[model samples]
Target chain A: MRGRGKKYWLEEIIFIGPAVLFFSLIVLIPFFIGMTYSFTTWNGVNDEITFVGFSNFLSIFKDEGFIDSFCFTAKFTVVSVTLSNIIGLSLAILLTRRLKISKPLRTVFFIPNVISGLLLGFIWQFIFTKGFGAIGSLTQIPFFKLSWLGTESTAFWALIIVTLWQTSGYLMVIYISGIINVPTELKEAAQIDGANHRQYFRHIMIPMIMPSVTVCLFLAISWAFKMFDLNYSLTKGGPYNSTKSIALDIYIEAFQINRYGTGAAKAFIFFVVVALITFIQVRITKRKEVEA
Target chain B: MIRILKNHRRIALEIVALLLALICLSPFYFVIVNSFKSYKEILIDPASLPVKWILDNYINTWKELRFPAVFANSLIITICSNLGIIIISSMAAYRLLRVKTKLNKAIFGIFVMAMVIPFQSIMIPLVRVMSSLNLNTSNIGLIICYFGFGVSFPVFLYHGFMKSIPISIEEAAIVDGCTSLGVFFKMVMPLLKPMTATVIILNTLWIWNDFLLPSLMLHSRELYTIPLAMNGFFAKYTKQWDLALAGLVLSIAPMIILFLSLQKNIINGIVSGSVKG
Candidate 1:
């Protein structure tokens, strides 16, 4: 072979030794530890632990707020992913056209993303509370001016609008890159075949940018699932605890209520759900990419 | 006639794009313009550009928010965390790519596995580890934690892009009596500039904007990062909208300026990073 196999083994050990140890200590070890803790009733602070197997997972089904949060997170993910792709892809197409102002427009659109999620939530909180009031008074629209984030129904939509506002620009940049990479020859060929704009987009453009769509959906779903700061800043899961996401629920369980076992169980459940969805998504999308 | 119709469609798209852009930017405009107005004026006329410009809110909020102190804290945390991340990630990436053996492959697999394991999965034990090590509630401890967490993705980014890089250069350098470390630093590091830029931009924005980790690990007031510091103003009773908005504007301004300067790279970085990662 290339050299003595033992030498190669030694070299490999020398090289990968640190990364393995680091990841184990930092990531893998902690993950398993968290899984173990899920089976125990370890009140986050005290070291006293009682072994309770599967009861934590069992309790999740009975927890009404957990169910609501799961449903809310799912609904949020679907709507956010769909809207983000549509708006983002549309903006990407428009901005990549032969327009002079597209450059500045792209920058303006992306400004909110540079700021922290907490900051965006706070900023939108201001607009929803104060700025929405102003728009309502000026335009005299009833729902437009109402306390958008006060009630459950309105608070959810308010969160949706703000999330879209903050994130669509980032996704747009991604779509822009994907669109730009589509072969010009293929596009021109479609044009020559007498395909109209809608037909070309439906057939050629959509399939070609399927990779970007996968990536966008993956990000949008995970972000929606992990969404906490916005809910925290805007409503603090308030006005009868309407906007509580899983991440927020975990935080509340851990910090607010100090229920470590329940929080750990909740967190484990969160991980499993997100992991399953993401695994399926990546597999399906990767398969599509390979097929295409 | 066909050309005219195409032109009309293009114009319509442009108008729609412009309206969407306005919707995207209006809130930002509101935040900036209202930061200069008095609280009473803002409450009375939130939409209007300040009728009489007043700098007092900015001045007062600047001091009350402890802008300079918190700015220093954020700078220290970001700089240290970023440096730690770059070092650990680059070394790990170099080692993973260069050393091709069963053990290395297994280690690399472990690193990839780290990518999907959400932070929520590990936070409970992580906190326990931190407190046990007396690493909680301090800036240094937080930076180390960030390094361990942040390195996985950057390493992945570097590893993927590194595959496309030819090994002959490194071989030649080794033949020239360069050590592995020297070869990586002298040859591979320079070649990795684009990916480095991507990593830097992504991680900088992440570190600067991160709230939850800092809020959890850091309990001390003086060590509070910008996000946590702004959150200090938000109480269960009596939320300060004016001060909060003003603080938000202040915290976002530096990064906005930075982002504006590096707009093209930011776009490229995000695209390549996510696409590859």
Candidate 2:
């Protein structure tokens, strides 16, 4: 018994030690250290660290830029989440109907997702600036002529359109798997009951694919909230910081502005909000999944 | 007559799909076309085809960005980080499940919860941690950071996958005088190929395109990844549309080719990875 126990211990250290060590050093320790830094006045370079009370948190609330960016992020999360899921699910339904072109079309939508968001930002910048310019001239369409990244409103919609273009394909794949797995008998039975396509969709299809809804919504919400690279490379939260996301805002405060303490505090708050929102989202979706 | 009606509907569906696909592909078209145009031509006739095709843009951008060096950096970082994540997560998952101890369960739960912590939250202090460890500057250091951030999801995936494998196989191997490590490698690793593929695809897609972590970690010009190098170029030459378009094309060429080749596996992997999670 003693020999077996010793062998088990040795194997445990050998198998699991590296994961724990690296995880702690990289994630766990930094997380706890960040929490402590939130209470101190550390400028990220100095060896001297002075502990302050909740002043950093207090100041973050007063920082209008932080508040503005938070609101912007929340708005982005709602719009992107709702629209992406709707469009994605719709595409899934359409493509799953045995359309001959569905396979290649799926590739078209997903192509944006494989490329880096950073690069996509640059590519779309040209589209908005030059491509739109060219199209506007040839067609004389007022819509294409609008300054996409110049104003707050158009810029907001431009980001939304780009995001939808990038992610709907990804969401479509998940929804496709869900729609494909809905047993054929269920659809046949619904039809036999004299249900029309819309009725069958509303009652049977939506409920059946509720799992996909949950997954897609969770992913969309998180991605929208944490959006940085696209926002950075495209607009850079431009037109007087009208489109700054919380992640970008924190990055600017901490790294660019060199306010490690305040940045850490803001990061902590960002963590709380993300945790709360995702937790609530999962809870609500899990309930729907059970009923379905 | 009914068959004709159904055929009409299918044809209509095909047309609508083709149109949408065209709109989806328009950006790539503009990018590819303009990449071959001269700077003066790009400015004068931004919408029209180039009067003369030129290779100067690609050649110039290639030298300016040091494409080969940056491409190698991205490749090394992605491959090494993926290997690290897989080994760490798979071994840890195996141990945690096999032992079934309270400590192991708690450890697994902790890792899962860490997935929810936004990178923004820990990133500031992570710099401090890395600097203190004397590992903030090198490719090896960046790969180490990837292990911490990237393993949580893969570990979760592996945990779910490893649950289905009958433990009796491992016990039988042990009884037959096989070492534990040997059992894991020879018996268990082969069974994990599907999940391994999923892990590799997702991590490679992520780490290769990620601009933030590399931006923070690698400040030296020689250490720049493709995205980082392109960002530097744009920051310097925002108006050089001719060269910029070429750089964009060169940077994304590998991903486009990768997608064209392995898109089926990638789509399947994404579906399984997300659904199971």
Candidate 3:
């Protein structure tokens, strides 16, 4: 009995040791150290750290860049989540129909997801500046000629547009799986009751696919909140910094400007905000999900 | 007559969906077409096909960007990171699932909870941590950083899949006097192949496309990955659209080709990954 227990102990250490070790070394320790740094005004280098309790946190209220960036991230999250979900669900509905082109269309839609958001931002930058310029000239359409990335509102919409283009397909893939798993019996029963197309869709289809809705909405909300790469490369958080995401704001604070203490505090706040938001979203959607 | 009308409606919807796909692909069209055109020609009519196809842009960018070196760097980082994450997380997940003790449960909870800790949050002190450990410059350092950040999701994925696997076979294998590690590698590991594909595909997409972690860890020119290289290229040559677009093509070509080859598995992996939870 003792020997068998000893063998089990050895196996446990060998199996689980590396994961817990790396997890603590990389994530756990840095997190605690970051919490410590958030108190002191440590300037990332030159370790002469002065402790100023909550002063960095206090300053965040007056730091207009961080405040604006938070608000911008919040607003961007709301709009992109709503828009992407709508477009993605629509595409899923369209493609799941008995269409000849569903397969190719799915491929086309998902192509945007394969490339890095950084590269896509660059690709779209060219299309907006050069391609839009030429198309505007050829067609003489004022819509294409407007300086897309020059102003505040258009730049906001530009971020929103690229985001929709990038994520809607990924979401569509999830929604399609959701739609496919809806039992056919439910559809037949709805048809037998003579439910109109819209009525059937509203009452039966939506309820049957509530699980997909849960996952899709959860995915969309979290993605919209964590958006950094696309926002970074697309606008560079420019046109008066109106498009700066919270992630970008944290990066700029720590790395670019050398305010390690303030960056750490800001990151802690960002973490809390993200956790709270995703928590609420998942709770809400989880309630709506109906088991198949 | 009613059936014919329904068929017509389906065909019309297909056409509308195809048109939308084309609209979705317009940026790709503009980027690919403009890439092959001369600077003057691009400005003349970006919508038009190149009057004189230009090979110089691709050739110049290939040499100037040091395409092979950056490509190798990205491939190494992604491959190494995925391998580490898979092995470490799978082993932990396997044990954590088999042993139903309170301590193991708490550790599993910690791993799962860390999913919400975005990379940007801990990245400040993570840099400090890596620098202190003297891991800031090498590909190995960046790969380790990925292991830390990337392990949580795969562990969660594997834990979920491990629940579906029966324990009877392993117990029987044990009765045959197969050693513990022998049963794990010989029996359990082979059964893990389907979920293994999911872990590999999803993690490959993520670690390959990640820009920020590598951007933080890698400082030297020789260590730059594709995203980092592209970022530097754009900063230096923002005005040189011809070479810039060609460079973009070079950067994204590998992932696109990989997608084309394994799209069935790619799409299948995503579906199972999402639905598994």
Give candidate 3 regions above 4 Å deviation.
A1-4
lDDT of 1: 0.83
RMSD of each: 2.2, 1.4, 1.5
Q: Can you give the lDDT of residue B41 in candidate 1? A: 81
User: Could you give the CAPRI-style class of model 1?
Assistant: medium
Give one digit per residue, the lDDT tens place, for model 3 in B1-277: 9999998898889789989999999988888888999887877788988888889999999998999999999999989998899899999889999987777899999998998887778999999999999999798999888888878888899898889889999999999999878887888778888998999999998889989988999999999999999999998998689999999999999999999889879988988887775
Instruction: Please list, in the order the candidates appear, how each scores on TM-score for chain B only.
Output: 0.95, 0.98, 0.98
True contacts kept of each: 0.59, 0.80, 0.78
Error of 1 at A126 (Å): 1.0
Writing each residue's lDDT as its tens digit, candidate 1 over B1-277 gives 9999989988887788788789888998899888888778887898999888877777877888789999899999999888767766777788888776565677678778768777877888888877888989688878877877887898899889889899998899889998777887788888889998999899999998899889888999889888898888655214555666677889889899999999999988999998887
Q: Provide the TM-score of chain A alone for each candidate, in the order shown.
A: 0.93, 0.97, 0.96
Report, to 2 decimal places, the DockQ of model 1. 0.64
The docking category that best describes candidate 2 is high
Better of 2 and 3 by lDDT: 2
Best model per lDDT: 2
Candidate 3 pairs with clashing backbones: none
Off by over 4 Å in 2: A1-4, A290-292
Candidate 3 docking quality: incorrect, acceptable, medium or high: high
lDDT of 3 by residue, A1-292 (tens): 2444877878888988889888998999999889898998988889799999999999997999999999999999999999999999999999999788898798889989999989999998998888889889989999899899999998999889899999999889988988888889988888899999899889878988888887878788787888889888889999999999999999988998999999999999998998898788788877887765
Per-candidate Cα lDDT values, in order, are 0.83, 0.92, 0.89
